[model samples]
Target: MGARLDGTVAVVTGASSGIGEATARALAGEGAHVALLARRRERLEALAGELGDGSSVHEVDVADAEAVARAIADVVARHGRLDVLVNNAGYGSMTPATGSALSEWRTMVDVNVNGVLGTTHAALDHLRRAATGERGIADVVTVSSVAGRKVSGPAVNVYAATKHAVGAFSEALRQELGTDHVRVGLVEPGLVRSELTEGQGAAQQAEAEQELGLMEPSDIADAIVYMVTRPRRTAVNEILVRPTEQAR
Candidate 1:
């Protein structure tokens, strides 16, 4: 309930819905001015409206490197600094290797891997600069998944690979930025009730629900808030959260 982020500026990618949307709201609630970025203009606008005065909305596809850089620059130009960056934008498809189209794999790599790179690269300077301010810290929280830690199943082959890549990327960034007080962290979440999971068939959905109890977006949002709100000297490197009933 503490306003640890009061007067800070936070940018959350994939903010149109689910974890991204919830994270944006949570950051704003903690008194951070939030910039919401997503491909869906309507959803971003609606969320911005709901967050009231300290929120700005931008429609952007994270996979577009140039566009992402420009958007991040614009946010810094307007807010003067970016204290937090949440790379929550990602895509997934559950197709086996044998029958899967290369296009699906490419999409996952582009959005899940390259998207994180693009957004993080653009925000790095801003985050580092923010760290030198009164708070003495800045944060980069990337929303990975359980898949990043392990291959849950065959259907998640390429998806898992993409997440794993980002995991490595996060660790490297953490090491490099630690000295600068820019805390780089990763959040790996298990099955959640979102647009991605809702696409599964009824049987799959029910099975997931029965096993994992279906996490709400707010669950992941809370984790993000915890990571960013840590004391200036403490950097929460990683968090892997799963449903109580989920074993894998």
Candidate 2:
């Protein structure tokens, strides 16, 4: 049988690893041509090879507005059309507000907040156009975090702020684009065993592995695919997914 997204095209940022990489693979499995975007050329190329045909890679830093715009344009040029954009490029520096340098906070804002804006701005025209195409729909899925839903700890100050920013933006975009048949959704994951989680201390990692069991990157990827595959009549606005043992 044919796949659900046959003949469609999808662009996934941060496709070099973690949730982004998993999302790209999942989209490709559904028969959408997947474009992997990340700063690491080697990793993207390697992933592209793993995904085989109907897959490509673009080296890009989401925080760079011009670079992101050009990358999206190139994807459209290569694929003929764009149907889905997964904004999964983000950073988290879990440092206390008092000790963390100003640059750290700013960097989080650049990648987590401004990056989303730049990609979304550049892809709006194409996404809207896709909605009117034969598929009659388009998708913009943002990989947010549990931090986006609520402020957790002092170390999550800037990261939480950036997540919150994206959450608000996704909601407003969903409101404005409903009539256009453009589905905007946010997947908020609590803890996933990725590079981001690996950055935490040994104690935290042990706790997660032993007590709560960190979620796999594919977990978040599945949530993203579900949001975009819904029938046109139903729009999944937001999904908050936490590990089974996570209380907050």
Candidate 3:
């Protein structure tokens, strides 16, 4: 039998590293042609090389609305159809609001909130069109955080706010797109060892150091693949994945 996503095309933002990279690889494994989107051209090129002919790289900053729109248009123009979009590009700066630089807060809002908004908006029409085609459905999966569900601590003040914004946006999008057969879902992870958590001093790492073992990017990737591969009648709207030991 053919793979579940054979003949489909998928776009994964922030594909240069971490969860985004893993998701791109996972989607390609399911036979979807993957479009790798990120700011680091060299990293994207390396990934594209690894994924071979099934993947293409686009150097883009998701926070830039125009660039994001162009990238999506390029993907559709090249592939003729778009089936999945993984909004995984994000920025995190964990510090008390009083001590944090205003620039850091602005960046968090741009990449975390604005990025999701622009990418989703650019792809909505195509996703809706794809829903009416052969596969009968399309998917929009945004990688959020456990902070999105609840504020874990003071250090995550603005970061938590951005995630909360994404959660609200995803829910509204889900309600609007369900009837169109375009599934909108959010994957809220607790602590994953990635660029965002490794050296960045993200609050999640401190939580992990307290004996809450971290999850790998692939774990979240698996959840995403599962969400999009379900039978057409199923719509996995929101999945919150935390480490087995993470309490809050």
Q: Write the per-residue lDDT of candidate 2 for residues 1-248, one digit (tens) a residue.
A: 89889999999999999999999999999999999999999999999999897898899999999999999999999988999999999899898888779998899999999999999999999999999998899999999999998897889998999999999999999999989999999999998989888888888898888988889999999999999888889989888998899888
The residue-by-residue lDDT of candidate 1 on 17-125, one tens digit each, is 9999999989999999999999999999999989998888888999999999999998998989999999999999988899899999999999999999999999999
Per-residue lDDT, model 2, residue 88, is: 97
Instruction: Tell me each candidate's TM-score.
Output: 0.98, 0.98, 0.97
lDDT at residue 112 of model 1 (Cα atoms): 99
Name the top lDDT candidate.
Answer: 1
lDDT, candidates in the order shown: 0.94, 0.93, 0.93
Give the Å shift of residue 54 in candidate 3. Answer: 1.8
Q: Which runs in model 2 stand beyond 4 Å of their true positions? A: none
C-alpha lDDT (0 to 100) for residue 237 of candidate 2: 85
- In model 3, the worst 10-residue window by lDDT is 200-209
How many angstroms is residue 28 displaced in model 1 relative to the true structure, after the best TM-score fit? 0.6
Model 3 lDDT vs. the true structure? 0.93
Q: For residues 116-170, write the lDDT of model 3, one tens digit per residue.
A: 9999999999999999998899999999999998988899999999999999999
Report how far residue 168 has shifted in candidate 3, in Å.
0.5
Lowest-sum lDDT 10-residue window in model 1:
206-215
